[model samples]
Target: MGIQEIAQATGLSKATVSRALRGLPTVAGSTVDQVRRVADELGYVPSSAAAGLATGRQRAVGVVLPVIDRWFTAKALGGVDAELRAAGYDLVLYNLGGPGGDRHRAFRRAMLRQRVDALVLLSLVLDETERRELQVSELPTVVIGGPAHDLRNVGVDDHEVAALAVAHLTGLGHREVAYVGGEDEAGFTVAVPYLRRDGFTEAMARAGAPVRADRYADGRFSFAGGVAAGAVLLEVPAPDRPTAVVCASDEMALGVVVAAHRLGLEVPRDVSVTGVDGHEYGEVLGLTTVAQDPEAQGRVAARTVVLEAQGASPGPLPPSAARLVVRRTTAGPCR
Candidate 1:
């Protein structure tokens, strides 16, 4: 039923009904209660678009991600979705995947169409032109896991996450540990893999552990990539082989686990493994990791963008941090 019918049933004016439905302070609390009761009885639903037009907002925020299939990205997006919905906002997802050509075209043609009030970019590696295009919207934008730019962003220090992984292995009595990470450096321009590697090196140095150049492997941030890295790591001669491995993501860690089992190497008993990003499967694998609340990050980014759209300054975006979560993935040095 329409607002007018609800108003008639409640014996309230249409204006008062609209105000009550919107939960405006101008409407008396009793009248709002009465309107809500009658509206519920009639199964009335308000049009968010109509309300948005009246308020000069769409009540919707846009989220752009490089790929939706990855675990980390999906988890982060999930968090953003919960936070925005709780605040009476909607999210519009934009997947900007593909090579530079298709990605650039999507950004220019579709994402900047002024459809969303504000934008949240999740782990999207935007070039100079794309950054300029985003700025053209003049909408409040928050970026997650992004390079340092003029726009506000929220994400953990990737380097620190990597360091924690490596540090945990070293602390578990592992002197010879290998680091594996993604080969694509485009996303690393924001210092993802490189910083993570830096953290690993720093941790090893601090622990006085030996750093083996051959132990470091570069692969994609996928299960196959992890398998490839694990194969190479397991191939090192017996005495020189790394007793532990540090992976950039849990997906890679799982791959390593699978590879280890195939190679007849038992985890934690023969060799230990740790990873970054507290994926759901990490607990199942008993993988030690550095956990960052991806959902919380998404929520914060959404809130920041919404506030910006409302012409309210959200101040500066807070720097994200990582915490170490110890699990059964690492153990004492093998004799």
Candidate 2:
């Protein structure tokens, strides 16, 4: 029940038991094993907060994201949660949705309370001031999707990922391909949509395809946005229509598919479509896309944070490589 009781039960000194519980390497291996077993038998759940005071480690990582409702964020969180649980760390989730009020209160103000050992920002667009605040924490931080000032990151190259999506569509004989995505004004100060748009242009140029400004439709990164955009594109006259469309996210692609079906058009026959992020539903829709390993990104981010907590330097950001997963959504030029 107490440190003395644990020590007595394990036949070890109280100091040794204490050292073992703290995970200090000074204790002998056998002593630590005996102590841990005894503690487990006693149903001892060590107080992380109390231990943090002595070790200067909270044994937890804070994860800040724009919205948890989105498919991409949910997938990324799934990966992060699994990795942290396996590594004996806690994940403190902060959904920076709504207006700037909750986000500022949670991330800018309350986060500095020293509740977590490090922070993991998942695809948030932080401004200079916000970035400075995170830096002042002096805790290890790993950003997913883009670079954070004085912090390490792990994510696919957004530009390259978009390029791959374009290249895949072009390779399928889709010359007149349209791009559908929304503006990057969702959260924070980063310009992800703009970067992805640049990537799309670059990819189209390399493929010798026409990147029509009119072909690009801005929409929300949701199923409904996709449907609306899809309707607009489908409304075009047959001769003026693009043979294929590339969506910025999987949800958008699903919308395109629905729109095509509504117009009595068969996917890849009447019009081909592709998407990024490789959502679970993409397979059911047979949508072609570039798969970025969200789970792997989460694990790497967690490991980076944990290492930083242990006084290790955060490594360079990981590269974003796109692996094409072809399905029924895209095909050669319309017959």
Identify the candidate with maximal lDDT.
Answer: 2
Deviation in Å, model 2, residue 138 alpha carbon: 1.0
Error of 2 at 153 (Å): 2.6
Against the hidden reference, what TM-scores do the models get?
A: 0.78, 0.79
List model 2 lDDT by residue over 1-335, tens digit each. Answer: 57888987877888888888766789888877777667756645445433453364567788888777766677778888998999898888888883363566445432444567777887776667677767556667787766555556687777877888887777777788888888544563254566677899888988888588889987577788899999999778787888898888888889999988998888888899888887989987788988887778888888877876776755666585568898888888764
Overlapping backbone residue pairs in candidate 1 total 1
Instruction: Write down the lDDT of every candidate, Cα atoms only.
Output: 0.75, 0.76
lDDT of candidate 2 vs native? 0.76
Output the lDDT of residue 332, model 2: 88
TM-score of 2: 0.79
Judge candidate 1 at residue 125 and give its lDDT: 65
lDDT of 1 by residue, 41-151 (tens): 675645553334335366878777766777778878998899889888888777766334256434543334344677787766677877876665566778787554677
lDDT of 1 at 311: 68
